[model samples]
Target: MATRARPSACSHTDRVFLYADSLIHSGGVPKLCPGHGAMPPPEGQNMINESALLESQSLRNSVLERTDVLDRVKALSLLPDGMHVTTAMVATYFGVGLEAIKSLVKDHRTELEANGYQLLAGEELRSFKNLSGLQSHTRSLAIFSRRAVLNVAMLLRDSEVARQVRMYLLDMEYLARTQPVDNPVHRETVSLDDRIDQRITHILGKTVVPMFNALIETSGEHRKELIALRAGVQRIERRLHQHHTRLQRLEGVRDDRPTVGVMAAMDAMNGRRFEHHIAKLLHRDGCTDVVVQGGRGDRGVDIIGLTAAGQRLVVQCKRFAPYLNITSPEVQKFVGAAKVLHNADVALYVATCPFTPEALSIAAETGITVVHRGLLEEWSAGEPLEVLE
Candidate 1:
């Protein structure tokens, strides 16, 4: 007795089709086809392919992962009604490009507005408090313009953001004043130079100096505070001298030319007077090795002195009109020359004005200390320079 054959795995419909097709080709009546049955094509095959299904799943997971990002951006958009967000703050929070964040907010302007988020204009942002208010304002702006947001984020995340910002602000202020003059004649005018210098000085005094002062005061030790304070003062004096040098250069006065001879002579006399005063002040404060204009050679090194601890210091002085800003290269060149000529332990860059951040960074990197106008003023006011042993 033969056992009944086990039903084929293929569906009846599939088997019937196969049998019919074979008969049609052979011109004979259709018969059941052997081994025609197989598992039905994978379920859901008709609606979506396997690859498509996998892709869909992946997309769902991505959406889930990005939920937090979207939520953060949304929450930041609803900061206190009166409070403003900065592009930097928003980019920082979302870990996105500042410009991208800014563009997102800009593209969704209506949506953000509906949700009580307002873009803080550049001017308005500047008016906000420096610490938190400015940060919030930057964030708010970043969410409005992707470009702004990304750029701001990049700047905020940068290690040298403060220096870059300070430089940018200076450049902008410089441009604002200089752009109005088109003619060579108008550009070379003394009034223009004076105005630019005044504005730069104002910015240094009002903005940068205060920040630096706060940093100096925050130092825990007397020696640290004194060093920081002296460095800050030197920075300011360098900047003022730089401005004056730039003004002279802009007026086409060659360094060796006699055209500015009288002016140069006047500056030299004023510098001597200033150095004399500084020397007297330092001497009165129990500093014994205070030497003024002691170095030989035409190099910029102005004074050579020794601290009470026998550490030698070489100083460079600039007595230009106020608001001149000095560059780092000048300071570096001076320091290099001084090191060679005096073999000093430290180089002190003394000026009647301030130095740019680039100058400050260069000094910091090269182990050269700076003494600006503010430090001179402070020292003259009988603030003792705490000795570090």
Candidate 2:
């Protein structure tokens, strides 16, 4: 019979706060700004009562039982400080309309803002616009921290989508409380490293577990000799650790709008997937017409579209490994194709990786705008691109 593994030294208290970390700051959860949005119909605090709280909490537990809930909400990312999700992300996760979410915020503006709904303004707003590649005329953005989302979910009773999201929140919180992840040290919370470790464990179970099991049973008298096998396992662990560390570093370095969402997407995608990602990003950035010509022979351009301003834009995409740098010859060809052959008003050379100094110099001199990881992050995250002449 297989032995039941002993539980690690992780605390239940740690697990309980996994979702609570959204609010309940060290000092205390603060109240929302007054007059931020229209009042809650003068219903007073009676609309959401203690029974609603209990029901929501019960529902939270119910949602937690399903294991794939987190995976379904794909926007969950560990920002530099903590796990973060946005209002748009919440809507997407619940399969609700964005305008519905906006309406919810409009109704419960004070309560949500108290819970950490951020209204971007001034330079921060401008920076966000630039990073997201948003044209000058796009609507202003409203971002909510994870806690704010939970508050809105709890009170949102009208929309079918909101009802689903409320259940999702309850289930997530309950799961975090009842089923803490079993790590080596028994961490109650899930972080990027924990997720990476889970992947490593899965890989090892598929490839190394059987080998180790057989070795343990067969090597009886020769068990001491098996010490050498430890080296191989250690190597595998080291490689996994290196990959995880690299990903965390990349995520940590960026403190921009839509930070990890764009970076993670770029790093994880390639070839046709990368092409589609670019197209989707363009659409999100308000491009009226965007097309991807995959497996093509017409011209050097991989993406052709019209910018929101009706400018004819030709985009050539280079999906490459991080180690590979784009060179000047590649730039020169695209420049000619975009400007001369296609008769485009703007030419964009986009690469998943970095560009060689010579390529950068050539692009600058020829007025061929190069979009590398940084610019790609900006554009993909919804910043408007300023097409160089």
Candidate 3:
């Protein structure tokens, strides 16, 4: 990733050889480097493979931000899917215990899923196992892409392989910062127009959306029209997103798709959209018969789903401001409907906001899994809750 001034003593051929050697030995995916067509292992190939980075959150952030390096850490043996690896393979590649890998996934499920981690279940699980030639009796399987594996490298602490990858990333970063750029003409990723578009989207999200909500709430006669108007804005926003995705794909790196994940997309969602989003996440996590039930006369239940193990699940979704907190009274209503009326085997109260201490206590005593902002984050990131089992 570093472009340096060629030293007079180092011939172009020697530079080519040296750079190629670095990439190969560092286990980076082979790529044709520019000019001499030699590739240097993208800085931090191993960083994605290991989960430990000397206890520095900044380092992890750095690795994630520079996903251009995902393909550099080559030598990944993928299954029949050609795009994903099982949890077992990841453990073998990192030379750590399977539980260790699972632990990292549990701790940083949000980040990993943002990159490409997934859990396969039901028909998906059966198909994957059949295609990959795996014979396992497990009801679900965890999988990761090269991108997700690289994320794990940044979080894992005990692997020597991971350490080497981190060291490689550091060297390249130092060289990049210190070396002079040959091109004097400035290059930019986002243009002025693009920034303006993003700003407009933010205004629509933070301002216009709440206004529509208020209008719909107060105006009994015009409520339906206001809702339709809001839906049109949402469609426009999604179309703009499609255009943005096209622009991103047209960029230099083919593997480097735009970094937008479901979490960021959820920020633009209104109450109804948020309910559907949670329902989709539950389905992705292997829930069967998942349904969104948010509406008048829904009796406090916003979602209904079945866990992979056949347990009945009922969920209540609250799409409040992130800074707000759910009160015990709010949670108590969900408990009565979910536990007493529906006889839910597992009840989850999911909110975009945090829960009050008393609210959390009530959830605990009532056996309701409180999926506050943090827990919902991980669940959205692809990690199923323990109760889902």
Candidate 4:
């Protein structure tokens, strides 16, 4: 018999034949070739159906889009020197949890590396972790992270994504640096009473005095401005008196403790002969038994006084700057000292500045009253201290 030529299996033409064969076998009705004589389905047909092919292409496109987005984020996170972005900066930007972001970065390591993006170094990441731990909030972490990501994106990518990321990160950085860090400490170690006093002083120095002075300078009519200024001063005086009364009540229990160095500084600042002027004034106003620089064997109590009704009061005086606020731990210390030293009925915190909102809340909850600088002045001047409450 004559040898018929067999088709080469490795040829493209043969593969197409196999594809048509498979398609016909898989419930696809075999049809005659349109131009050529009857032929087999193409090899590509065996490997993929039209519907599946489209779906696969769509999936691949989606993956690419996601990868691009991640890449842009990473590029913005880099610096001009090509250092990997800091995790803290990135976490702060994204408004997400730091741990959560770290985990995401770890989980997506392969993806990031494949795209030519490097993960943040261990040391850099550690700093972020420490900051996040110290700060104790997800909002800060997210903001930090987002910023880092934007820097990386700027360095790695030249696309519009990079531009947008840079702009957003810059705005965020501005806000973070300009605005106050919210409750930087999870637990406060400073006195609440001191914080309240400090806040009062801050308001008087920064807000009250400056405002009145400006009004006085700008006012055309001397009498009107003077009257307004006098009224404002009186308001402040009343507040100070109330703060002093509260301080007297709180400090009545620690009568024999040595005074702290800050007390002298405060006395000088206030132009008083002694730091105990507030206590003395209160004593002269029938809140007697008030002692200055008193309180023995007490860790935090500064002044001690006793009401006529025999209620012992423990006081802690704080002279702090306006920027440095007091913490809850400080309040706790004074309260603990009062319980141990005098078994006082009330705990009072008097500060030259303001108490942080957190400290104020804690004082209220713990029944530790706070007296600010304004109130202290009112009490010292023998004015009604009722306005503060």
lDDT for 198 (candidate 1):
49
TM-score of each: 0.32, 0.38, 0.38, 0.30
Candidate 1 structure quality by residue, lDDT tens digits, 1-389: 23334456844333433443343335332232344221122222222222332234332222121111222112334222112345556655554566865565565455445433455556655543332222342333532322222223223333232222223232222322332233455444545336445445544444444444444334334424444444464366456745554444345333343221322222334557766756665567555677676446546666666766778766777775433667888987986777777787867676756688999998888777777655644554556555312
Q: Relative to the unseen true structure, what is the C-alpha lDDT of residue 239 in candidate 1, on a scale of 0 to 100?
A: 63
Cα miss at 183, model 4 (Å)? 51
Ten contiguous residues with the weakest lDDT in model 3: 252-261
Q: Write down the worst ten-residue block by lDDT for model 4.
A: 172-181
* Residue 131 in candidate 1, Cα distance off native in Å: 39
Per-residue lDDT tens digits for candidate 3, residues 1-389, read: 55545567853334433454454335343332334322222454332212345466656666553332332222357764344789988887777999999999999898788888999899988866765556789999898976688777777778754543454455334333322223223233345556455555545544554455455444545445566676676556545654554343333222222222333334345789789888887887789999887898787798887999899999998887543689999989988999998999999888876788999999999999998765776787667788876
Candidate 2, residue 304: how far the Cα is off, in Å: 0.7
Model 2 stretches with alpha carbons more than 4 Å out: 1-258
What are the lDDT scores of the predictions, listed in order? 0.46, 0.56, 0.65, 0.45
lDDT of 2 by residue, 302-328 (tens): 888888788897888877754468998
Q: Please give the clash total of every predicted structure, in order.
A: 55, 13, 19, 84
